[model samples]
Target: MRRHTIRPLAALAATGALALTGCAADDGTAGEGTSPGDGGRTLHAQRVMQLTQVHPQTGMTLLEGPTFDEEGRLLVVDVTAPAGEPKVIRVDLDEETAQPLHTDDRGAYTSAQFSPYDGRLYLTDFAGGAVVSLAPDGGDPHTFFSGDVDGAPMNPDDLAFDPEGNLYLSDSRGMREGEPLGRVVRIDRDGEEATVLADGLAATNGISFDAGYDGLWISELLENRISYLHLDAEGGVASRHTAVHVDGGIAQTDSIAVDADGNLYQALHGRPAMLVYSPHGEHLATVEIPAGHQGLESATNVAIVPGGTTAYLTVSGPAGGYLYSFEALAEGTRQSNGG
Candidate 1:
């Protein structure tokens, strides 16, 4: 299924037809037996909805972010979706409706995270090498941070925040080739500047802070490993270690999200699947995308609803801009500010 030109907002605005088909929520949920109290890791997942199938007016070959706001709206971004069409969209989880919010001609966009404190959306422009931001209503796009140290390009992939309002980003300068130029950075409480936390990485990808703010995880794409960062009292990286290192030609790791109990849900590349691991690097469960589903190829990042047993995913590939919800066995770690 090559990417198609589905201008959903334009089509919906003209013809009041919002095609939300092929979406159903099932009772069988994931993480049923896999719980923190049980002292074990391993869970199952049941598909709830295939985004494109539910709303067939989206075309994206590169889909990534799936962050939600406190208002129950999920912010989804596409990179050169429909070939050179980069845009940010919002989906009402309550009503199951989709709408385009903003479009950028500057460069390919990768991720957009809604900030609770500032009431804005933080975005990563892969080609332009900058961290931009905007209002929740998709207004006033401006550069929040740009450039890089040593006068190099800023190739940021994913972003995460700590309990104290510090921001962390994975800089994938040369990720595709697994170059060691990748790095992990952190911003201060005022968001005025960023400092390098760790360097000499191999295509650093997704990132997530533990629920307790005790650890931070960074994905090393092409290397099939997830780096675990031990935090000091102030949330700085005290020690860095590889928590989940997949070998035997398994798969490449992408974005990651953490649950309340410190369970990490990671997306795999070589195939469409989700791998859950315990905090101790214990292999918990592998959730495989159902075949013949609406959109399963190129499954990338995941956003688990807080206190809700559901994990919403953003998938791309031949058919892009797909959103999915799966039965999660546990609750996701909520932000300190209740975002």
Candidate 2:
């Protein structure tokens, strides 16, 4: 395992203030608790390691989600200032080197995911309010779905794909001061689009589907709750409900990931811990991370590898960020249950 350390910004600005208010030091132990898992099972998560920093080739201002491609290379979206010039960075785990995958000339890119079916990458442009599809080899980006769905630019945030190749995105509306309410959208493979989903939400940031692909769950950063959109037989979102809500003042719940057993893992943006939830939206435990490195002031994204035994977390600091891997102790339980 490699360790990198970076420094946090001097001022306790927006990011720093949020971190201080949300996280409290723990005994450095993996979260211990039991919650209802998928099909009467129980789920748990322990903190294996805390990565101090990640070294990017070029400095990234605000980094968000990280997903792996077929080759296991990590692709991350960097949404910094200069508005129209966000970048996509690829990190090689084997060599510990980072390279630019793609750069935007139109707007800032926030979250990104790789399409296994087409091998293309799909990303959300917060400023442009659209989703752009780019070639994996890095080339010109095509407008897969621009939220100009009724004339106005729909504020697109994070996104996830279903088994049928349709992309489900979150359109966080209330961000521009006085605008429409936030809603979830679905885009077809052929570029055909529909606002099949809508909800009265606040800052709908990260989203993910269940392991069985039967329901969709989204993180409401402003409201501090995880919202659920039940899936129908036709793969359409049929209904909506609240999955989980944090009781304390830690409201900045941003990105989320799911284990093989259908348990949800989310990053408490304002806190240094990762919150784990059961399929029924029950808070099971919190994976506490020590506060030694700089970027640790903010933990942005959480991801579980395919085997379900390991997890990757992104710790963002002032200079840059790094990725940390954690080993899941209950790996055999998830594997045996076909998670």
Candidate 3:
């Protein structure tokens, strides 16, 4: 297990004060932020798909999860799509086309992941408070986990699976107004058992394992903080600490992906960009849309395909939903594949 250490206040300033320009110094020299426009080594993401008409009931769309199936096709979910509209979409990168994979009136899936153990797709339903599963072909849909854990209702938002195939979920209950009812849950490989690994979080939105699988990185939307939970041999949290905390920003930290080199790619909710940070919380780079494409500001999640540095981000807002691509900091691993 890696030991935790407190970073200097300058490093904290580099992370919290997002307006400053330049990369963070490992020696705590305090330079921070990339340039406002596209110059400061900003990776201008290219659009891959257009989902302008996905949501009929609400003109606005919210694309949350972006994961690659075993066959390397991109899969994402439309959280704002009403009943009778397609919620799950599969994108073919080679063809640059998207098609609906699943639609159900009872589901408001916020994230989708392909489980490593069963080789099936699993989705987290935020509104329905359940985890659902299906084959990659979108057949034989089944509820993987539901109801309550520890006698408390849960709103499952995002999920991750450990190397052993155990599932970890982020329960985003009571997070809209910053309520502290959020929780982290763990389920067995077969989905027959569940446990509340941690609780009392304010809008636990995204969950992902680190490069080493030694811990988990959790993003809290309301607080704009990333908490690292060091895990023991049994996948239990042994300790906790804030790894990244950005203060006074309209951008809410949403979904995150970890590279094989331990760098973190964090998607910003209100801003059309992704923040790259080192494992020690050093600000690395800001991947954003080009200057003219400002309409795509509601970036939500990121998915880096396994064994490669190519990464895709999910964004939605006035221009509807979009899939953007950029080069990742390092080669993607199992930790980067989902949620």
lDDT (C-alpha, whole model) for all candidates = 0.65, 0.60, 0.76
Candidate 2 residues lying further than 4 Å off, grouped into runs, are 1-60, 81-86, 175-180, 329-339
- Pitting candidate 1 against candidate 2, the one with the higher TM-score is 1
TM-score ranking of the models: 3, 1, 2
Model 1 alpha-carbon miss at residue 3, Å? 9.5
Query: What would the per-residue lDDT of candidate 2 be over residues 1-339, giving only the tens digit for each residue?
Result: 212322121111112221210112224433334433433222223333222223343233556667776677767766542423337777776666677777655656667877646868888877676788888866878988775765555667778877667777776655334433667778776678666476667767667887777888787766778888898897776888887876526437767777777777777665555666778776656665544543454566765555656666666655344555555433312111111
Question: Best lDDT goes to which candidate?
Answer: 3
Q: Candidate 1, overall lDDT?
A: 0.65
Candidate 1 TM-score, C-alpha based:
0.79
Residues 1-339, model 1: lDDT tens digits: 323433212122224332221345645544544544435444454554444432223334556778777777777776554322437777787777677778765645667776545767888776666888888888898888887755556677788876555678887654333336778878664668778888878767778887777877888875778888888886677998887786515456777888877777787654566777777887776665554654445557787776776677776555444665665547764531111
Candidates 2 and 3 compared by lDDT, better number: 3
Best by TM-score: 3
Model 2 Cα shift for residue 165 (angstroms):
0.8
Model 3 lDDT tens row, 240-263: 898998541777777888999998
lDDT (Cα) of model 2: 0.60
